[model samples]
Target: MSTAIVALCFSGPTLADDVSPELVAFARTQAAHIAARTDVIEHIIAQNTNHAHLTLEEISRLDVHWRQQYGSQDSPLIHRLMNTPLSDALRSLQLRSSELITEIIIMDNRGLNVAQSSVTSDYWQGDEAKWQQTFLLGPGAEHVGELGRDESTGSIQIQVSRTVTDHNGHPIGAVTVGVAPLQF
Candidate 1:
């Protein structure tokens, strides 16, 4: 009988220039959990299916309203979406792994948000690095965004994204997860 051991590693924060082998290993392990969770992935896909029929006009209208109401202030969309069953469902799903997750955002194929765990700065994420990497790169590609500080919590985090795909492996949407590095 034989057993295999897997090792994990992570580079420290950009400014610190300190690399903790243990934290690196922890991050790698937590990253696995983030990537391999079927339930989380499925929730995102289910949301994509729910909004698959959305027209550009509808998204545009919401975007316009969001911008007008929130402008540079804290986004009110979170509260708006939270009132809906869709966001409620997502919030419930997120609660299952709240310890490891900082934020969750589900976006349609067009990069417009279908639902989110919290209010974001905008309704569209198409131009962001995370969306481009996950949605544009097609399925099987995971986008690991650069580590940054969460303005609200002031905690360092790394954003990760994966393309949402249909049973036939066609790209449908994308899901982004903000993870606190220390938790890993």
Candidate 2:
């Protein structure tokens, strides 16, 4: 990727002045790597078909269900997400990052969680800027969210998101990597 795209990844309102350039670059690299993976692309394409017909109300219901079962051991939805090979891959990435990465989440074209390294506050991310600024903006777009405390990791972090595209360069989904800047 060009330096300009990397710079753009960290630009805009969500870019915090206190965040380290090295850390931002690291996150951007991770995002791009994840986006290029064939498994990630294939999984998202499959999910897009599964979720294509879901209405807004159905998404809200699923989100509500996810929130209600957030910490419970009996959540089928969470189980399905966490048990996937993709989720395992994400978790492995997070573990290998030596805590620089707090979490990783892969969302489908509709922004519903396809796989996640950890349980998120909600299932649907379509309404969030991470999804909008990346997937909605088209391929190669990125969004670095403002620094905040990640509930799962309990670390102050920023979520760096990038659009996932297929071989045709069509937007398939988005991946968000939560990085703890203090780890830099």
Candidate 3:
């Protein structure tokens, strides 16, 4: 019984274990999916010194690791980030390539939704899967969750994210992208 108790205590991750196989697999699959497409959203994150690809801290969370932060209502980034409608973005991706990227949400350090590809109009970006990994519980490597759903799809959506950084490599935010694994 004492051994059982010890096993239970050691069962879950304690911020030292290497990232789970599931997470690593999801990350690889997401990168591959995005890489397979060119006209659609590119996995490429670098543009210039001012513009950059998302960072490991930004793109690491997926379905299981709940996000944990949100942007301030008084911030201008909230306005600029959320400016793009989810419908428009989804439509563009859908029209551009045969590849699939069903939803995309901008998550802050706290995991709140700054912007999304669809739904989430009123900012539901706090302590959810996409935002939580970077801010909470682990050795601080990238994470990926298995397929899951939101209020709308009722289908499996693969979540992907990386830490967003500035030109000086300062951590700024996170970006989460979701794609339907198997459309029903």
Candidate 4:
């Protein structure tokens, strides 16, 4: 991540550097649950055959909206953080494991978010890091990242993203999700 983007990626009230023990445990709890579902998210993207994959620019625009609406707020925290719409449907998929679920979303081949969980504000299409290595790392590959502090909850979170593919053996897009340590 460049210093410029990292600067832009963060917003709202800042969090303290001192991470609590509870938060550490929460992040750990979220890891496996998030890990198990990337492949499932990919399946969903694949099924949406009619959906056109978004370009990186489109995703960036959505991120801008997300930031303007949700990221700018500091109250009614849950509203800013919930991905229930996405997660509820995901639950029906009979996931291999239920660990820590924070957020989830589908991205087009061009790296725009199609639909997702816990999306407050969109920014730079999951950062430049994702765009660079997604192909080299393989489909459904996951990346662990610190998603900055949620102004409402004062909690820290780690996010993961997995690539998605269609039946034609083509890379269609990806599913990116996050899990905040329950300790928050």
Candidate 5:
């Protein structure tokens, strides 16, 4: 009984129970920086503005369509999007971040993927807690998602999401950046 109590006390909090304050701060600061980038801001604004009238359901369905099409290796849309200069720019940014950033996913207001550094498990983020919390709460909102190991990168990462607001401070979408805990 005493040993059990001691073990429990020593175990402390799990990553799921709480994210370190330093990592949270790093995420917030990085998210703000990403939001302030001129090109990134412009891209988000343009995507959101173009699809401003889309309802939540419509946006989710669009995500499904994109995901289904991209699943095929010979997908024309994926090839075109992934081979463009824009993709090169995104990949460059990810490389510049070193190992700290494992992945980057930018979503439109409807939670549809606008751009991604790598392919994600899904396209629609509306159903995900990270997207829901940040998007619904608008700008200044942040969500620290689950901690897990990336099989491909073999890095322990936590998904951090923040609202992507426009010039007028209106949230146009959200961006989730994966931070490797060991690097940070």
Candidate 6:
């Protein structure tokens, strides 16, 4: 973790026509800010490199395990991800937003979670549009997911995802921020 301060902005075209401009702007600002953090970038890079050799079968296994242990207190994998400093930072960011942000998930190149504000339903997001439309799309790419109700919080929110690029401007990962439009 070099903690290098980089100035980055979301330069992609908005992908969701139904999402309001204000919500999109808010999401983009949060995504760009997170993308510019060296700690986040480094963590994603390290995780991506570490899991680069995992086969699809291995990924599915992990995903299945994660789903089985989603809300379990004894889940080793979920416990590891939720207790990290990066997860704490994400939680703090969500709290400080005064309910505008509901959740945040940082994903590696392969769509495995590097950090998250809270426990997600599943582990592998590689098959989801959030990752496919962003990390797989290239640098500056964004995907605004459809509006949905958050089960835990009972709030209507939209997931905004953007490609997280390294200092050299290469796509290394993706970040999805859950935003509640009504919070604005």
RMSD to native for every prediction?
A: 7.6, 5.8, 11.6, 9.1, 5.5, 9.1
Model 2 regions lying over 4 Å from their true place:
1-15
The runs of at least 3 residues in candidate 1 whose Cα sits more than 4 Å from the true structure, single-residue gaps closed, are 1-61, 67-78, 151-154
Query: Which ranges in model 6 have alpha carbons more than 4 Å from their true place?
Result: 1-16, 151-154
lDDT of each: 0.61, 0.87, 0.43, 0.47, 0.71, 0.84
lDDT of 3 by residue, 1-184 (tens): 2453234234542221232344445544553443233322221222222234445454344211222223234544334444554435544654453445565555444444444555443343445655566434322324455544545434345566555544444444455655543321
lDDT per residue for candidate 4 within 97-176, as digits (tens), equals 25445455555555554444444355335464443355235655555455566443344455555555555545566555
Supply the global lDDT for candidate 1: 0.61
Candidate 4 residues lying further than 4 Å off, grouped into runs, are 1-62, 71-99, 123-132, 135-140, 146-154, 182-184
* Residue-level lDDT tens digits of model 1 in 14-99: 52113244444443444345434455456557656776787878777777777666544564664666566656655665566545
Angstrom error at residue 52, model 1: 8.2
Better of 1 and 2 by TM-score: 2
Q: Which residue pairs collide, candidate 2?
A: none
Per-residue error (Å), model 5, residue 47: 1.3
Best lDDT among the predictions, by candidate number: 2
Top TM-score prediction, candidate number: 2
Q: In what order do the candidates fall by lDDT, top score first? A: 2, 6, 5, 1, 4, 3
The predicted structure with the larger TM-score, 2 or 6, is 2
The deviation in Å at residue 153 for candidate 1 is 6.2
Candidate 3 TM-score over all chains jointly: 0.47
The TM-score measured for candidate 5 stands at 0.77
Superposed Cα deviation of residue 150, candidate 6 (Å) = 3.7
Instruction: After the best TM-score superposition of candidate 4, give how far the Cα of residue 45 lies from its true spot, in angstroms.
Output: 5.3
Scanning candidate 2 in windows of ten residues, the lowest lDDT window is 5-14
Model 4 root mean square deviation, Cα atoms: 9.1
